[model samples]
Target: MPRKLSRLTLKEQADKALREMISSYRFFPGKWINVERLAKDLGVSRTPVWQAMMDLEKEGLVEHIPKQGIRMAEMTLQMACDLYTVRGLLEGLAGRFAAENISKKTVARLESILKEQQQIVKDQDVVEYSISDFRFHGLIYDFCGNWLLKELLENIKTRSRPFVCDITPIMSGLYQDHVEAVDALKNRDPAKAERVMRRHNLRMRRRIEWTLTREERE
Candidate 1:
């Protein structure tokens, strides 16, 4: 629940900061992240930095090699596809629950977010769209009323950052998908909402694959 490092314990604060940096692609995949340098950069002691690294290792975002240093985990194409597949399944469940339980006020708020998403996409504002996308999905995760499911999905999403944060795949098609998914929720159609949300994520995997294929050809 704590978004800011100041709200966490010292070790947790270090973990949160370092996790943000890694997930944001500040440390590229497979690059060695020096604990000492990171501590200096983060203005924290090496102890907390080490502690944070351990936490990240458990999440598979980073790994400690024997006699080497901490390196950002390498994301294979298979891993990326798998991550999106699992995300689609989990978020599909979230969508189903949200459709059954979401309030009218929440539906209105989601529509507003979708409107902002449309404008952001039109403007080609990737950063703003990413934030809006997170908010849109996060609301559904919360409204689903399944705390364990939400936590599990959040962890998987965090693991997904190694791929999602670094890629610049085409996103123009997603705005409409978001629109349709929101419309399903507005109609209180659980089956349609789940199908739409799952399709949205699965299509994202395809876009990512297409981007990779093009890169290979290039």
Candidate 2:
């Protein structure tokens, strides 16, 4: 007898495959991805692949090019600036909320994340460091107790992953900013926390600007 196919299992498989493709730059920025070839590579049929593409499209990671099928969404300096502007506002609000409502347990958890981040920086493990960076903001969003803000930040994080990952190498100053932000949270100073968070995001925009300038010159 043949094995039964599971819809839930297949969707999960497709989601994971799509995430890997996006994270690894397999579906590289500005490049058209052949869905049929991707389906074959993942050992699935076109149906699941198409489903995964739809999910990615909803997250703004993939674009439908009409006759060209699907392509990775390209990043531009204008997009980066616009994203960072929104992020600064949302994340600054998160920091302020955290300062007001942060528990001792949450502070401890933030410290632990910071310690791990410090080690990753010392080891020069850029990939792990970047993952930790994501987790740090995720923790703040989760602790803020605002479901809507949390979901929005999560979506923006997914959409911005390619640009963020591409710029991880220029993040040496980020660790100190994290430390300062956490310290502000510990002190329960919402204003200070918001300032630190805004400055951190502005730094990210600056890095993106530098990268765009270099690309333009090239």
TM-score of each: 0.87, 0.85
Q: TM-score of predicted model 1?
A: 0.87
RMSD of each: 3.1, 3.8
- Predicted structure with the largest TM-score when compared to the true one: 1
Clashing pairs in 2: none
lDDT of 1 by residue, 34-149 (tens): 88877776666688889888988988889899999899898877887888999999999989888899999999999999889878878888767876877788889889889998
For residues 33-75, could you state the per-residue lDDT of candidate 2 as single tens digits? Answer: 8877766666667888788788888877889888768888888
Model 2 scores a TM of 0.85
Which 10 consecutive residues of model 1 have the lowest summed lDDT?
Answer: 1-10
List the candidate 1 regions with Cα displacement exceeding 4 Å.
Answer: 1-8, 165-169, 215-218
